[model samples]
Target: MKKMFNYYSDKYLASWIIKFLDLIVVFVGFVLASLLRFNFEVAGMSLSKLLEQSLITCAVYLVIFSLSKTSDLVMRHTSFTDIHGIFKAVVFSLAILIGMDVFLYEGMDYTGVFLIPKSILIIQALLVMLGISGYRLAAKSIYATFLNSSSALKSNVLIVGADVSSLMTKSTLLNSSKHSIRVIGHVDNHPKLQGKKLDGSPVFQLDNVINSSFLKEKGIDEIIISDATLGPAQKRAVIDSALQYNIKVREVPPHEKWVNGELTENQIKPVRIEDLLGRSEIKLDSINIQNELQGKTVLVTGGAGSIGSEIVRQALFFKPKKVIALDQGETPCYELGNTLKKLPEDIAAKCEIVIADITHFRRMQQIFSKYKPDLVFHAAAYKHVPLMENNASEAVETNVFGTKNIADLALRYKVQKFVMVSTDKAINPTNVMGASKRVAEIYVQALNSQQNSTHYIVTRFGNVLGSNGSVIPLFQKQIEKGGPITITHKDITRYFMTISEACNLVLEAGSIGNGGEIFVFDMGESVKILDLAKKMIQLSGLQEGKDIDIEFVGLRPGEKLYEELLAVEENTLSTHHPKIMRAQIQPVVSDEVKVLMDRLHEKVLHGDDEGVVGGLKQLVPEYISKNSVYSRLDKKSSQAYA
Candidate 1:
């Protein structure tokens, strides 16, 4: 029977039937009002006059209802907006009817008999509104109750907030026929709301005593957090407590993510490890960044990669005159172009994608000559530690020569600012990738010393959470496969930040850097790889030792147990921004740097792997190889210097 009702309710015939029923209800309300006004004496009122008044009332209501389209709304999903529509239609229809009665009576009165008394008309309007609104509200209530009570596989839920968003979330869940989760109660931090009731559900204050026993007593199978006001630490605490009880935990995104200004059950998602990192939101100087980028032709290399693509997105926010995203990857660069094409017409008109390698000097020179970009963000480089260890020449060619190409062209084109993205691995480097980046840093710093129009800046930070080779995505894939998760070492750790945060700070650093300054971001704290793996397994609702196995493979070539942000010889000075600091290192002589780079470039071009490693050691004195084939060169360099 319910299925049949649902099927017919969606047909066009149902809408017309509802409209016809509404007219009959309005007509009856008018006649009933007249009977009541006459003290239940039908003889006191002329039956013909009452019938004529009923027709007029029904006609007016039909016109007004059509205009408001109140009958077009589904009865089962009716809300306050629908009720408001019905009220407006009824009041407007009666107001016009009263005006017509007064106008005709004053102008043309044949027998001096009134169509409807003013008091009767007012009573009729109220009756019509209630008749229409009450039925819809009752239908919605019945449907929600049926959905909640009829399900046999329902899971008891506890909401973590008692505010407006939580209320909406509960309503959405209750109204959804496909969902079987029943909200049992609310948990809030406010003492005043401890014993209060939200829609007849009791609210309890959260305390430290919450545990598996408390959850079991409440019969809670899941906890849904819908409060954006709670800090990360508080949310983490709730998640941790819920996880201990083996109860599923989910969270709603910020209000801005709601579709069409309405929350849906699908928007609730499981909590992620990034939420537990406890990093505060970054505050950027938008006006300063806009002033530096607006109406300027900007270029971002590696713009198809993670950090580079984010830099492109941020640059578009500043309304640059033209943003040229240059990357060597054909597929990703094409995808970036498609993404930009879907942006607002005005914003998309200002973006251009180029598939060109940064190592090709002639191609880069052409780009610089044609566009003459006013600002350049250099992010192209080979970054895999183990991969670069075997192919050291490729690392030098891309990280070193690629950066040098862009920096030189920026000088020749007289660009205003040049920002090179570096890594924390560049500090006291132990890997070929890091050493190559450090060498590029030295050259850019040395170039800044020469009289030039470009203000060269370098922003260095640690590992980004979901970048190309980051461990988070790898762990996620392994967990999905339900197999052994591999770790390089149990004690390995690295500083982490979101890609968005890192890019925002990079732009901030670019705006504030004068010249020859390496800006290091405050990457909150280093996370243990072993602990991260365990938390990931827990998040996936699997046991570490039983459901999944974590195998510790010894450290890879050129890999270290820890990463550094600053070298021993480099000291940092506080900057205007809280999260950013300036690294002050001994200046490199430009003449000496030029001679060494030329020699290193020759070796790299000739494919002399040994000579390239030898030149890298000579350039960066602190570039000691660790568990790599290049370790032999460290001994050779020490002996040569001695």
Candidate 2:
């Protein structure tokens, strides 16, 4: 039964057969009208005359319909436009019959030519309209039933909005022969749409929680969000409610992303954790960035890493003279080269790949002297907390010494701007990684104080979503392995920004900075790791305790429960861009910073882990070690001072 009307079995009658059926309707309508006009007294009627007149009526209807080509339309797909064509054909045929009747009134008086009465012809027109409209509607409804009942339609769904786009989305989803999903109804919070019907389905309340009974009653196993006006908070609420019932949720791509102005099944994507962050798109200070980067050669040090790579990609849009992607990772640089090959030929030619370690001052200096980059973005660093706690010397080697190497060479080569990417952990340092970054920041700021040739800028932001070794990917792997998801602490919270947004703001900060300024990005709200774990479990269609367990391990070495964007002693001054802020810090003279770095480098040369970490703490007095072997150093320093 399902196959008979589905797309595979979509067959329509031949045009000749449909024309014959239409003529039969016309003949039957005329006979029925004659019978009704004569009060069913067939004996008083002239049977031979009635037969001739019915044939004439059929011929007239057929000519008009054939001329209008109404029968060529598929009955199963008949629309309002098709029905209107039939109505026009019927009225036109009626008018022609009326004209014949008027001219042959004398013949009717003689009871010889045109024997049918005008009253009978009028009634026949009404009957023809009803008959033509009824069967086409019946065919269309039957085909719809077959499609809805097909085995291909496996899931019942609710569209997210009750608007014109939602209605169009419903029709597109259901009407497409290739789609396997069925739209059960629409969901909206508009009070005006409550208790109302869209198409033949009822609009359900949006905020109501989905219970088992309601799920069974509505047969809702999925929902497709198509509403552009629905905010992130609203989307998160719906997603949470749907996941409670194990109902799958998907979202439609924005209309601008539609393929060739039409929606495709491949374009409807699954909801991602990033969308739940509820932050709007940042309005980048593009004018400032463009004016700064245009026609200038730029260099990004960690150019293959997440933040660095995004910077390279977005920078190409500003039509720079050239971009040098300098990274030590051979494989990542190669892969980035392949990806860049997919860009326009002219743009692809603008990027130059180089493999060099930033810790080597001569290698960096050589590159800077050759390319003479007008602007430089220094992003490479060791960011992991526990690993850096154990390898304090190595952290200082890359994050501090590497940064100083780049900054010193930038000054030598007369680079226009040097932007260093720093993390929020640098604000109130608890880990060796954070301490090293803070020391690097201090060195750059101090260098900026003494220099007027090259401006040194520091852009500080929090963790970026889906960066290497981030929590979200960690939980995803644990979930895939079907076991407990490990978190440091239940109350631990951290700020997050999407990688693209953070890098764009970095460019904005680089554009607006003159010299020696630390720009802090607004990281919106901090999300609780405990809540994030639960949401991930639910999103995977599993219960936390029932299907998989969530284990709260104690905090790792040098890890903190909360991350801060600003130190207590530091305050921020507003920038032209609302999302970026310039931090006001007490300045250190160039001589003092140079002395401290020289001592730190000497300790690094002697491979003294303790001495290197001790020097970093002395530089940033706020630095305090936690849950690590380095905490002993803090104890010794306090005891000696006391």
Most accurate candidate by TM-score: 1
State the lDDT of candidate 1 residue by residue for 476-550, as single tens digits: 999999969999999999999999999999999999998889999999879999988888888788888899999
User: Per-candidate TM vs. native?
Assistant: 0.88, 0.75
lDDT of 2 at 426: 98
* Runs off by more than 4 Å, candidate 1: 1-13, 16-43, 46-52, 59-74, 79-125, 190-192, 206-217, 545-547, 638-642
Candidate 2: pairs in clash = none
Candidate 2 local lDDT, 286-361, one digit each (tens): 7878899899999999998888888999898888999999899999898899889889999889999999999988
lDDT of each: 0.87, 0.85
Give the range of the ten consecutive residues with the poorest summed lDDT in model 1: 4-13
Pairs with steric clashes in candidate 1: none
Off by over 4 Å in 2: 1-144, 147-156, 162-182, 188-198, 202-220, 241-246, 256-266, 638-642
What CA RMSD would you report for each candidate? 3.6, 8.6
Query: Compared to the true structure, candidate 1 yields what TM-score?
Result: 0.88
